[model samples]
Target: MGRNTRKRRTPLATKAIAASAALALGGGGLIWANFYASAHESNNNAWGNQTKAANAQVATISCPDIGQKLTSVPRQARTEVDGELGNLDRQITDAYQRLMTTRDAQARDASFVQNSILQPLKDRRKAIIDRIKLEINRVGGSAPGSLDTLASCTGTPANQTTAGGQQQQNGGQQQQNGGQQQQNGGQQQGNTGQQQGNGGQAGNGPVAADFVDITKVQPNVAAKPQKSGNASTGVFITRCGVNANKNHNTDNVIVAPGVTNGAHHLHDYVGNQKVNAFSSNQTFLQGGTSCQNKNDLSAYYWPVVRVQDGTQDFDQNADGGGKEGNVGKILTPVQAQIKYVGSPTSKVVAMPQFLRIITGDAKTTTNGLANANAHWSCTGFENKVQLTTQYPICPQGSNVVRTFAFQSCWDGQNIDSANHRTHVAFADANGNCQNGFKAIPQLTMRLVYQVTPPTVQNGVVKNAFAVDGFPEQLHKPATDHDDFISVTTGGLANKIANCINNGQRCA
Candidate 1:
């Protein structure tokens, strides 16, 4: 059917926050109507004491097995759905607050009229519906409701038609671009405006579209770690601890600013409640963390992983349509180390909060794959040759290990640089602080995937894996990166100094 000929009842556009308003109206109207009908029926009860007991019994008899069937849905799907729903709830809450507080209609309209959340929410809801149906079918039960029967506002304002037409045109252009990519055998890797033909030798290999060429880039080889203090001198404190559990679910404020529902995808965080593009040192310290150390209020975060059967069923782009989530569950690192590495005698002072640094470049999508500092191996294959593969399958009893080591040598000045780098350089191979640069506490993050494998598929072990990165990154393991915030206070800093220098294992 032609685009306009196809039928969909949901309203395409509105001057106000149409979805929220519609949801509110439907919910309130239903409740009020039900209450009124019940009251009227009670009045007609011939027996003045009309069996309130029988009705109560009927209310208590709950539906069977639907909850059980829901459990059958994959955990990754469940988490994705829940995350999206939570995000929508946040949007609705913000919208309601704006509507209640704002006197100006224009301002309210501006906040609500944007289609970013509307379409994405609809897509997620539909996904949930489809997943539920599949689960029900697998369990040999009838679906609770038909997809066509789902309630949604239909009809479009005249202005929306024009916008929709333009969107369709843009989509056509994108399709053409996709065709061009196929003709050239692959997509372009945007690095310093360098264009390597997809078939050219300089291009990244078969999986290059998903990774950066890390082999060629001057990798940030970490300095040999050294302990700073001695226990005999009373400088003993544990500089390392792991933050394993999740603390919050939110969108990336740094890369996809202002788009609350994540124009890209959702991220899971372990520390710093107020993490966003505007989050600062004071903000992080003021917030809390899931870390064992209350004083070590640093933030460690990455994208939630979802396991997939290797299908291109996601957006994989921060600014694209279709599936906007990664294809697999992101296994938490087997060990996440939070410690200081640098010159022990430097006597490091306070580490500032919101000092953001990314260890790997998510933007590079080719020859740059090996250009990252990703170390991947199985439990038993710790010594196995590690390469920059988009995904790694480990042997049975072994999980995939991913580690990220950040630049340690700071200029003794800026917390951040203009390019988000350059202010800090890596320590020398000898573990010595760089010349003219002061040794700062270098934070490191390590993640391990739970793809216990004895199996191999496509000549590689099959594993559930993903990295926290831009969708354009294609979830390539090479694109995996880590973010950190220094929430260390005075006492904690003193302890860290002692632990690293004194060579104590105290936590």
Candidate 2:
């Protein structure tokens, strides 16, 4: 055995170990790449695709879902494993379609993102949706699903209740909790039923209103100013709203310059010249919301929701790395997100919020139609809760500039975009700056509540409240008002009865 320090061992053992090491390293890298791509390719953009031009440069979105399984498969086959991920792609489409058609308002809550779609697939869906959105933004455009995905994803999705809620998905096309009549068959409660509680009767409340849909854009592009600068819908508002120390007089404020910053109104924001918010093909997905001090540093007032990264996996079998996009996108699911917790469902709610006139206060103008600058501002909500809307395309050659705050009350604060930030900052500003924050001569709101007769036992009856953590809750003590007043339904007060039972608390 001493023929030169024992017979030489076969080289095969060394080769095997080295090969194994390379294989493991490659596999780990591919997985990491998948996550990397997902993070980097999000569409947290605010400038919607309204202003984009068809001739603009379009970025390609490659979502390849493939992998070199850890079998003894040959490297040649693995390297050439280019195929399709139709199943996964279809899953995403199906989810989006489902989101758009859902009757349950809860499903569209911002926090429901993870609960309904992404987390369930273990990030597969997340990455894909995020990437698709990123791609859309890159091309200065967006897909219909892009809107659907963020439609109700206000918080970030995946709330503490998501997993629980999914498990509690009562077995029925429509769950009958206490034999209540299911009225969600696209029925309009008219103006009366929308504000009044659905206690099986119509009452003399604020009277039912209607949502106005703009069928076409006005050809004229002139700016209009308000007269008195103070108008109100004269409806009741929730407690938190009042407690926020805000002036329900938002309706009273006017966009002095008119359309100065919004989609059609931004002519002043850029002096009639188009300004693009995004200059590259990158995408940004809205991130989960976190509590931030509005009165704190202006820098952190609106931190980006999406955590962006670089590098994309273009290899069919590779994950998030390799190439910039050979691999499929799979962003993570946001947890406990909320769009707008306990938003109102009547025009009266919106009247105090979104509407205003450029002229004198309070006129019963038409909701959505071309008017002769009679009503400078336009907004209507609550009455029938206009869930979703797709705005008209911008005039030719004008791509969407992406507004920071174009949102539905149902959007919650999930987006926390520039449009909203601008408004918030404007409100916080003084004098002239605040003057144009909201359209002037707007209608104001005040909220009122009366307990359902049969549901109450005595004066000590149970009540409803909207709270921070509980989105469906309210400020405290509900009651109607004539003009401007704040109300956050919580604790107890005049509305309470001696008995405790089901109390309808609509925020």
Candidate 3:
């Protein structure tokens, strides 16, 4: 189910110095350690101790993503299927919480994690998967026979402690980018018995190793694809004031239409007023807009980024906030730039109304990195360097930046697919639409935040910031994502197409 074929840029070496001591549970019976070292560590005496501490296990549960495995669910069964999918997510979250809280039991008995936690989780998941199959069959749709096999889950180590300046391969390319290596300086022992102030208030993530100083990273951005003479080179800009209305929610209308708190993380919304899990196509058509142009009522939203400085937001006690391991003071974007550009190979066509598109993978930490699309950088270093796995530490007078370039090719018929991704695709590396798809206006979003750079001192991070995500995901940057639903009228859609095809920049 890997949609995007574009090669990912290699991550810069982290330079932040961090170290965490191993925790001893009850008379030193069981030891769990989560430790990291700086890339610049050259001391022979200290290297041996740090390397042994890094080998201690810090594990989390990993389950198959059921939604990605399904390619077809009947329209009549979609509502029930989506709800069941949300249930699966909730089950995992609950299991992860149990795994974090039951370290004492795990230390006492070797089989505690498997017997008390993972097995029960698998049984619950099997029941849910069976229910999903019945719903699909009830509507006369064929469910995949492999659905039964996806019910079993496994324990996987979460912490990855790499040697300082070690080289890694990405997409068959060798990268040797140099920079100040920032190790995760926070006290992040994933299963360490403590609850608060361990990497984050939720005791999961945003460790110091998750950030890289942007000034030290070498330039690694590739050149843009070349445009032919027939390319639509014009641009269209939309001004939707950056979530000033304070519209925030955890429901995703496109993925889990009828389920509340479906996203499991809070999203900052703009451009549409009437948006919720119950919203329909008609609701979007009749809703007011935040854009200056009244005719454009598109809905644009992304996961809110937060500073983990012990400040609690209103939702800190709610389902998708502190309760789900997403805690901190929410930081509103200083600027949100929404733009539409044309294809490099052909003229663009109008997008269908209510066409739903999602850019990044929300479960990428466990799902692997085939569909991860988030890019992070600083203001002036945008053209020089971009990071996919780590957050950027911007210099003074500069702000943090997040960029998302969505899929630009449409399948020409369905507004959405069962997987919510097969209906649209990214163009090939040469910028041509394949498989009978048509080129549409490419939507790109840029969000800027004025954040005080976090610092690591005495193996603890101060003012640590992270993107909101599922409890198990640990707020990794690769899990950052955005959602959009097109609500343009026919006239406005036609105007946008004409402007791009005629090579005229319009606003």
Question: Candidate 3's residue-wise lDDT over 1-507, tens digit each?
Answer: 434233232232111111001010111011123333244533122212223223223345678999987778998999999999989998998998887777556545546666788899999999999999999999999899999999987755433221111233556443322212223333543232222223566777755555667776667675677999999998999898899779999998888888899898999988988888899999998889999988899999999999877678899889999889888889999999998999999999999888999988888667755566778889998888777666788999999999998889998988988888888988876788878889999999999999998765544556778899988777767788899999987488878888998999999
TM-scores across all candidates? 0.48, 0.18, 0.85
> Between 1 and 2, whose lDDT is larger?
1
Q: Indicate which candidate wins on lDDT.
A: 3
Backbone atom clashes (below 3 Å) for every candidate: 37, 123, 8
Q: What is the lDDT of residue 241 in candidate 3?
A: 88
Q: Per-residue lDDT tens digits of candidate 2, residues 1-507?
A: 000111111122122112221222111010000111122333222212211221011111112122111112122321111111223333433343333233133222433433554345435545544554454455554333432243222111111111001110123121111111111112223232222221111111111110112213222222222222221212111222111211111110121111111111011110001112221111111111121211111000110010011112122232111111111111221211111111121121221222111211111110110101111111222221111111111233321111111111222221112111211211111111122232211222212212111111211111111100001101000110111111112222112211111123222
Worst lDDT 10-window in candidate 3: 19-28
Name the candidate, 2 or 3, with the larger lDDT value: 3
The digit string of per-residue lDDT tens for model 1 on 194-291 reads 22222111121112122221222222222234544421222222323333544334454433334454424445566556676445466777877565
Q: Could you tell me which 10 consecutive residues in candidate 1 have the lowest summed lDDT?
A: 27-36
Indicate the residue-level lDDT of 361 in model 1: 48
lDDT of 2 at 379: 26
Query: How far out, in Å, is residue 242 in model 2?
Result: 20
